[model samples]
Target: MGTSFQDKSALVIGRPSGIARAVVEAALAEGAEVVAAGRDAQKLRDGYGDAVRAETVDVTDDASIQALAARLGPVDHVVTTASARARGLLGDLDRESLLQSFNTKVIGPAMLAKHLSITESFTLFSGVAAFKPAVGYLGVAITNGAADFLTRSLSLEMAPVRVNAISPGVIDTGIWDALGEPGKAEYFEHFRTHNPARRIGTVEDIAQAVVFAMTNRFLTGVTLRVDGGEPLT
Candidate 1:
């Protein structure tokens, strides 16, 4: 609840780029000691260096999540921007893809709540597709929708240890790189023109919202939509 994270310790589980990396930096700037973990230990170590305690864990694996929890002891804040999405149209979807999506974004965080020593707050990552649906995003939709409810359910179970989710819009997180340069540009341009905010979101925009979710004690059980008001227009 306090502005100062001077004495706080945070565990951020995700890759060493974009939203996760931004959150780690933001916490450090606010004077919190951070442990950055992801599936690739080498990448994490290489990216964070001495500035943070870089580690490794596969959120989709229960043992991996538990092992990291035991090793880290207690932490004041827990965050996961980790995501595994299955993007395809209805007929193209497969069971394994759907399961991967759920495990990484929804079930993985659920297991994290069960295993991790969260002393303060647990921040999960959701997505705007849960609100504004479209073709080729059914897998993304169901997984993110579940995560939204998971935030509320965990808030009740975690109680005083605040539980919330950050539902981000189209941030420049390199997730769109799969679309190729021109395609990515076209996608962002569409949002720029149609969305109420009239601009693509930056990682900093998401980081600011995550800080609010962590600092505001009254914000539990909520899914903070940092989506440039896309669902509205």
Candidate 2:
């Protein structure tokens, strides 16, 4: 793909961190007018400076999403990295958490499609956990699986607008920072040994994949896996 977004405009919905922040930076580098939208306008502005138009948007709230869409008008691309983490065993999972997960991953994107007049494409975020199900992350897996199907359905329903999803593995997006340094090292080692790529993923890796999905016209109704061969093993 050509590395130029000269006249393009993009709206990235999620906090200014991890893959979302990298996507904004990548879009800016490619000359696109970008809006880094999230629940916190100040956080977005603080993270991106004047390079992007930071707007407040809570994907879970229909009114908030609609207002942002109205203010921005039409956009060339809409990338939603918004997701809620609901972790627990099947028995331990509560109804509220499960619904919240769906609201964030599945319903939120559906709402975005309903409100936003996306001209080029819409990209949603999923995860490898959906494919390689784990013991305690049943909620995450179910919601991510729904997200994949949502992308496929929207791609057909939305027609020429195009829609796709990206499923990433364990990337060093600071999400693992909560697991102290020692804990992180142990998990990273485990990931390295288990994954076919024998290494962890980076935010840049996933960001590049998002850029590919955004620019490629022929790709739709697909979930591009940006994982380091994690699912393969």
Candidate 3:
């Protein structure tokens, strides 16, 4: 059976931008009462207006996540796109950066599962880095891989409440804004030639996939790859 969010409630944790923002918009369009949670309350309010209830949350802190859970009561779906970027070669990595990366990408969501009274499902954000490990993305690969494992484990433990991970490939989510216009264009062109889809993924692609994972009755303990077939290459 398929799921609809006509009257359901969803909590999205992460910055109110990029793929996270797209997910919030999509959820609202589907009639879900959405709550946008992140470290920036004002940013959330500014980005989403009154369409979503902006709540502050620091996923790295257990207390913060628990407190937010208490405030929201129960929710039908929980989607955490929260992450911290730690880029460096394995030998050059620092202990603090590595731990912080794991704390945000893996441990944070694990803690949410422990505390939140979720009624339906929990969808975590993994990435293509987990599969196609790059030179400077060692820390990201490790944390994302761990998150995928955590999702599977939680699916078994959480039972009736489904758990899954969405591993998105190189998407044009403006996360590459740091690359500047020229660099961003080059990046996409490189992927455009190589990826099987011959194009980059989009925020809408990921958002729709997330909704599917949340509503699909029998999909749990799985990592849905929204990558443009990059891993296969």
Candidate 4:
């Protein structure tokens, strides 16, 4: 008896991401059958190897999501890694961008909960932005808040189907690399100075929190903060 979820099945939305990739690996190592969904199935295959079942899913599209959900046979746990690149101030953000971000971060996970079996638990992603809104972070804050609230509400409504969120602070995901070296350094420095932990988070840190929530039957409707006490700053 290795673990109860040894042969359990999981669906991880947005498999190529830093957190998502770590989760897939963790789940598989724990004897889980993981379905890695994303826009690029090949990337998932390349990264996770041939053992993973890859699905090219566009979360923003209703039909695409519906079709995938229809085929996800008896999903025990669902974790969504889908997130949009944050953008805009309150005044500068447009409807389409806002909706795109919302649809991915909020609607996508909601739909997954709606369509999937989710017999055990469902985990969604949120961020510290939801709690500590910042300048030019209007969309991110809105979407993040929406996601956390959605999980809490869904947890109540979908009882017995544990639903929760993980709100991680600045993690060392390479997406930050897209911000360029100087930007990355500045961002990390801010987290280092401001966070109680004195360093940014890592993908594995967030993943461990996810595992705890999902495996603990007594927990639900909670937003576990895995930012190493980042908000305490």
Which regions of candidate 4 deviate over 4 angstroms? 1-4
Model 1 per-residue lDDT at 107:
90
Give candidate 4's error at residue 133 in angstroms. 0.7
Mind giving the per-residue lDDT tens digits that candidate 4 earns over 126-203? 999888888999899989999999999999989988999999988898888988999999989988988889878999
- Alpha-carbon lDDT, every model: 0.92, 0.92, 0.92, 0.86
**Clashes per candidate (backbone, < 3 Å):** 0, 0, 0, 0
Judge candidate 3 against the unseen true structure and give its global Cα lDDT, from 0 to 1.
Answer: 0.92
Flag regions of model 1 displaced more than 4 Å: 1-3
Superior by TM-score: candidate 1 or candidate 2: 2
Clashes of 1: 0
Q: What is the TM-score of each candidate against the true structure?
A: 0.97, 0.97, 0.97, 0.94
State in Å the error of residue 21, model 3: 0.8
Which number leads on TM-score? Answer: 2
| Candidate 2 Cα misplacement greater than 4 A, ranges | 1-3
TM-score between candidate 2 and the true structure: 0.97
* lDDT score at residue 153, model 3, on the 0-100 scale: 98
Ranking 3 against 4 by lDDT, winner: 3
Per-residue lDDT of candidate 2, residues 9-62 (tens digit): 999998888999999989988889999899899998988898899999988999
